[model samples]
Target: MPDAIDVSATPSDLTLVQDEQQRTKSRELSRAPFEAPPAIPGYDLLHRLGEGSFGAVWLAREKRTGKQVAIKFYTRGQGVDWSLLSREVEKLAVLYTSRNIVGLLDVGWDHEPPYFVMEYLENGSLASRLKEGPLSASHAVRITRSVAEALVHAHGAGILHCDLKPANVLIDGNMDARLGDFGQSRLVTEMSPALGTLYFMAPEQARLDGIPDARWDVYALGALLFHMLTGAPPFRTPEAEAKLAQARTIEERLVVYQQVLEASPAPTAHRTQSGVDWRLADIVDRCLERDPQKRVANAQIVLDMLEARDNARAKRPLMVVGALGPVLFLVALYWIASTVGPRIVRTAEHELLQQALAGDAVSARILASSIETEVRIRQDELVDTADWTYVRQMIRDSHQRTKDELSQLNKGNFPDAELQLAFDKVTNHIKVLEQRLAQADRTLDESWFICDAQGRQIYRFPDAGKSLSESFHWRDYFHGRGEELDESVPHDKVSPRTKTGVSLAYLSTSSSKYKVSFATPVWDEDQKTVLGVMARGVHITDLLDQWEPQIGKEGRPDDRFLSLLETRGNRPHLLDHLRIEEALKRVGTQERGEVILRVSPAVEKALETTDRLEDYRDPIAQLDPKFDGPWLAAFYPVGNTGWTAVVQERRNLTLEPLGQMQGVLTRGALSAFLVFSVLLGVLWYFLHRASL
Candidate 1:
């Protein structure tokens, strides 16, 4: 081992060759309280400032420089190991020139009270500041970084601040940390064990025979930082203290301390504290590792990591700006392209709409004419049935007989044979009318019937024997008007609202299909007075079949289709394509009967304006509950009837070229974006490699 002697000082005064027991006894004897500050030559002691186990520190002034300094005096008594004082002074002298270390002014070994002077710091120590409470993260980190720098200097000088803690760190006038009080400092080659504060010492260093290592200071630095952040040391919980109190000897207590740190979970309160980021927490955790080898190698590496953290923080704002600039530019370009593309699409859409409307108008007119022709043929046939002499005679005879039978029925008398003969005659007459109606070229009539002038059915072909209620007076066929009466009118007051009529379409409960009746009044021999009425009934689905094929099929909104509208009343009503298809399926089959058509606001608005609509939009396509999209629509009147034919073609299908253009533009933009992304990625990869 190298001799513990400094050549600059006297050999007897500077040499420290004492053993461990003698040094312990010297520290005990040096703690003797002094009654007054001891005077030292070349330095005037002002007053006693603080005291430690080995010495008392006093405020003093240099006579030559008039500079205030702190002097630490070791109490001289019998059996004192003067080597203890020499060893501390030797370590301090080696680090005196460092900015992070306290400067040693002079040493007075032969004085009555052996003393050494150091530069006086007005700001005191970190332990005094810690009494107020935990510091802010920024303040704590700054202090910690300064202390770490001081450790870097001390470690480089082969001296370990084994007792490093807040009390050992003095703050200068500038508020920077200067590590002081190296009384327990050990050189790298020293084999003697040194003890440090309990909670701040590493587990491996918490032993009586522990040798001084750089890791011990590393652990103490972490504990110091932990104290500054949380206002308390790590693993200083009540349970740990309870176990520590049970140990009787220093060796046992040290063993308990090691076991407590090893058994307890790592400290995390620092991590959860406000402003304590993961990077700082990680540094503390690595330094406080239970395994000495796992701890940070030295304080210099901790200083470097803190610098790296600062560098990362400094680049954060620039990184955000670099990323946002390109993203915003691409967004602006995309917005401009979208605006221009839609305008071009709308321009082509307007021209296509005009052509589609013109074509639909022609189709509507043709379909209306065809429906009118078919309806007129059926109406003529109905008029011919009413013109038959026997038809008129039979209706008058049957109405008279029904009135007489009803009179008898009121009196509780059974209908007579004469009433039975009258019904048979009307039945034969209806059968002949049915044959006549069947002979028509486009015979779509479902049934034929005769009614009394009072609107009571006398007979009906196909279901002549079915007994119906006396509720026929309110039927549209009997009154020659599309609307029904709330109550029946008297036989004497019964009159036709129209001479010949095509009644509004109605849901037939038995068939589940809509039916419309064409009726003509049967007159007396003079052809001036009405006797009764003759009518033919036809399902609405049959008429739809005639015009539906002339338009397109019922599929998507874009498919063309024909809608027959009744625009005579408070609102127009049209048969839904889906409903019409359902009715067509039951034409010759049995199914649940339909009750009524629910009025749709879209259908009403579309057909309400006029019997002849030109260049109109299909409101049902645009505003219906499903929002099917716009269509080019045209309406044409079916003869003099209140019915109108609406023909429509989807506008999107008509302007298909616009969709193709948009698709091409979309593909081009996506391809460009992909290429730009690939190029940017390649550039970034090259730049990253070059930087490495």
Candidate 2:
């Protein structure tokens, strides 16, 4: 046990005790007065200052020192336990050494239960001052800083003033602050049923099985600051039930704070009663962050911010003089450009024109068509991988079925059965295959499309084809040689094959893999002269589905896994995973399997690279190395038409280890708390003169 110091400032007096008894008797006539004489102590009873749910505090003058002090007496039936009293005494003893903290003078049994003596304060608590109005921002900050400094010391000693509030802080004659009420304080690691006053209680402290931490004090400090600035705590209400409900969740309290901040008139616009700075209001807001993690970690940070704000204000004049001076000195430079710079430009242009000449039309047209094709291919490839795969598979299945039926007819195997039966079977199979083909065609027709060099449609997904140009002329194929034509190929007047139904076209001569007819120039074989333009298209949807099996196999439980390919541009095409998987199964049995095509960011980048267009860039690529878990993704490119794949997984399954680590940390914290409690008890006994 810790030692106790007997610093009772009030002198022994019987008159004060009788006066208190009379007041108590007047308040409650039914209650009996003490029949036994108040004895067994060397202290005197004094006039009662206030009574609360816990106990009453009295102002008394110690007989030995003749110093005025406040003595708090706990009643036997006041719902306080001996163990709780002992813990409170322990905390007060440790905190007494700090000047800003209310010092515990002595603990003695003057009546049925023990009472503790503390240094008396002349000025009332901050709560009493707030009864008039909210404090000016600077005044509140100054008071808060003093209390915070005391907390910094207490926390350093592993003690938390769990019940911190305006009422618990005393103002001296000098207006300096002294933090009081260690009756509910505890070591940082200790978890006690007695937490804090309802309004000041942290959400975690309200939990039945919550593990106490330093954050509890942090929250109370914020609440105190809020009260100082706003004239009330964030959740103060006339009804006790309402206050309790608000204390249940930190988020609800934060919402209230945000509403108050947003709705309340700006403090800067209002004049302060005390000549205090308004900037302190911002600091209070910061301290009241909804997330504990985002709050100021300690008192030091608050002090640092205050100091920095002061320093910046002090340096403002210097900044204006040194930096602003140069800008003002250079005001003449702007007018010089408008008045004298154009004549020199005309002279230079005239000299350069003599050296320049126009290039040949044939070579220029070919170059322009090649560049246009490349740009179109790149843009088409920017479709999402999942969408691309679905569209590709649909096209591939349609083509395969068509080819298979043609082969069957060529093989002459349909005449084996009776004439009626054989005809019916062939008709039924053809109808079913035709339906499949029609569905595939519908899907591919809706996919997006872009033509390559020689007027070939290198990327013709259904969505792309809907708006593609039908016909292409020689002039349309080779227009913009000097400038880059990286824009999307729009469906306008170009002629398309109605049977094949291509909606849009572009030319790409940059890569061999996707070179299309749009890139090829028309030639007359007999006359050996350039003729016109030819168009070609690649079924983009068919190519996308080709990669579905690989993605599905990589993520087992194909049904559970969903893949998507999105185009890397505005109004991108979508290829759903389920659609592609169905297409792959229809392709028949192959070991490596049919390639399911899907548009993805990777495909978009590959297309762009092949199209002689700038490569697609991803911002999240920087964060990928850190995120190692699986997720359902819905990613898209930041600027370019590039696809982003968003994958989502079960939260519990993904963060299992993190949960286990938290459990370990929780247990360790609890164990550390218990050990600290025992040490606290020992320290308290030695300091309070209760040592064994």
Candidate 3:
């Protein structure tokens, strides 16, 4: 900000100049309580200020609110009609904002005649100010720019001030202009029934039923600028003005308007003058174009030009700042970081740990919810594989045929050649049944198998060309010759088989391992006989691995790991053997004669209660030679499947909110400063423009 800008002083204080009669009329006073008809009943009439063509404006006080106001009363004798007075009020209702606009205060049409209640301006109109003398280029641009801003506000709201002129614009105590008098204004969507003051109307605006356009106001502003600069109307010559005045009715006026103003461009008032600003003159001339299309597009563009004029003059100090700002910003940023970075990091360290821990727990909980569905699917697979009666019939027929063949051979009822042929045919039938079973019992990590009531393996899917080397009865799920449950080994919860029913049993094929299997005894359709045991095994790790990426993008984070843990026994075991990459685990027990890694305390605690646990601290460097601690851990129990999902994380894995806040605040402050400086420079430019 420039030193000349009195930041301590308000904008209102700067606009008030030393003048007497002007100041007296501007003064406001409360009126004594009064009541009357044909007059504003709620207001005390202080004194009559001025009278327009149809109404009389008075400086008065509203008795109820006690606020000083300018009341324009429609005196029936002033040659005014209800439409003009009503139109003014309707326009103000839709278009108004900003201190630069003499806004509507209150209105009344309840009496014999209505009146306008509006914000009172102390400095009067620009026409009154111009009576003293011509304004300098700075004062002219500032005043015009202020009015342009008001026009922008009005146009944005779809109202065009078609009758914009010096008399309709009021200047306040701060020398800021306020636009008023919307009598001739029209909605942007409506055609004009009448033109505004002839001197200010654009060529198209003068025509009856003229469609509303933004260029109408542009022409008025140019006329205002021209009047401010040259102390005359914007017309090329006095003859052109006289010619427009000679036209009488709407039709005659249209002809003269075309002959004079629209015939050709002539000497504009600014061009005829010697000591005028060419830049401002050119803008005014463009606005006064006979063709509306050639004029400036909108009031906002004129405002931008005026603002740009001020900006161009005040570019000196801003250039200096632009040259050195980045260098200083970098240096200041470095200094602030050195002074405050550690404290910020310390405060954020604890928060980062908590966040990372939360991410771990959340990811684990998500993965845990998926386990029940997988278990159910495995159960369904088991039931589906065992439900085949054809395979069971083939096995029964093979056993029965073997028995018959042995008896026949013992009875010496067949020749050696005949016996050999019958044996080969039975073997081929068994092979065909094995191939059919293999088609139905295939998976990512499971195979199909069948055994006789004696625990001897009979059929296997992938071992179609070979014989079973081991009996499945050794597995716990197949205890008691695949029919009876061991007293020590409880029935599998998932699709467990009944002694004489068709249900299938699902259990761990290999104890303390990721291998799961479903087994059922193939029974006769009459429920009278058990054929053999049928089983399909799937490695649970394959399911876990397949779901990891789909759930929270597990294992993608450097500081985190996701593991599935089984919690069925005294201690939990990693289903996938997910241990610290290069670290050894402390084992507490052996499962199925193999030393296995156990779940961390966090996971064990989760299994005991609450299905979820957080805040496990393990040194990452110890876990992985490539990384270091402090790593946080969390786990979720997968719904009675006795498996848990555990997520791990380290300090380096999460975002740094404080550091990002620091950068945002720094850039924001720098941007705010630049904008503030430019505004102050613009205010300083008022002095330069005024001098010119």
| Alpha-carbon local distance difference test for all models | 0.68, 0.45, 0.58
What lDDT tens digits, residue by residue, belong to model 1 across residues 150-222? 8888877878878777777788889888888776788754646777777877886776666567778989999
Give the worst 10-residue stretch by lDDT in candidate 2.
9-18
List all candidate RMSDs to the true structure. Answer: 41.7, 29.5, 27.6
Where does candidate 3 stray beyond 4 Å?
1-39, 64-66, 77-81, 271-276, 316-692
lDDT of 2 by residue, 271-362 (tens): 23353455555666556554443455566556656776778678778656634343332332234335443453444333222111010111
Which 10-residue window of candidate 3 scores lowest in summed lDDT? Answer: 1-10
Please give the TM-score that candidate 1 achieves against the real structure.
Answer: 0.44
TM-score per prediction, in order, is 0.44, 0.40, 0.40
lDDT score for candidate 1 against the true structure: 0.68
Candidate 3 residue-wise lDDT, 1-692, digit = tens: 00011123221112111133433332321122222325567888787666433446778888988888887766532243456558777778776556667788787776655676887777777767777767776687888888899888887776777777777778777888888877767665453344665557777766654556677899889988888877755554667656655654455655675566655565455765554556677778777876653467678768766765667657767657744564454455566567776676666666555545544554465456555555665555555555566556445544433444534532335445645454344445445544654574423535565666555455555433333534344454554233334343422322223432111223333333346555566766776666677665566555566555433433454545666555554466555523432243332223221123454565456556753333444333333456433445667666655566777654444545566776786788678567656765676688689999
- Scored against the true structure, residue 522 in model 2 reaches a CA lDDT of 27
RMSD, candidate 3, Å: 27.6
Model 1 spans > 4 angstroms off: 1-32, 76-80, 326-692
Query: What does the lDDT come to for candidate 3?
Result: 0.58
Residue pairs with colliding backbones in model 1 are none
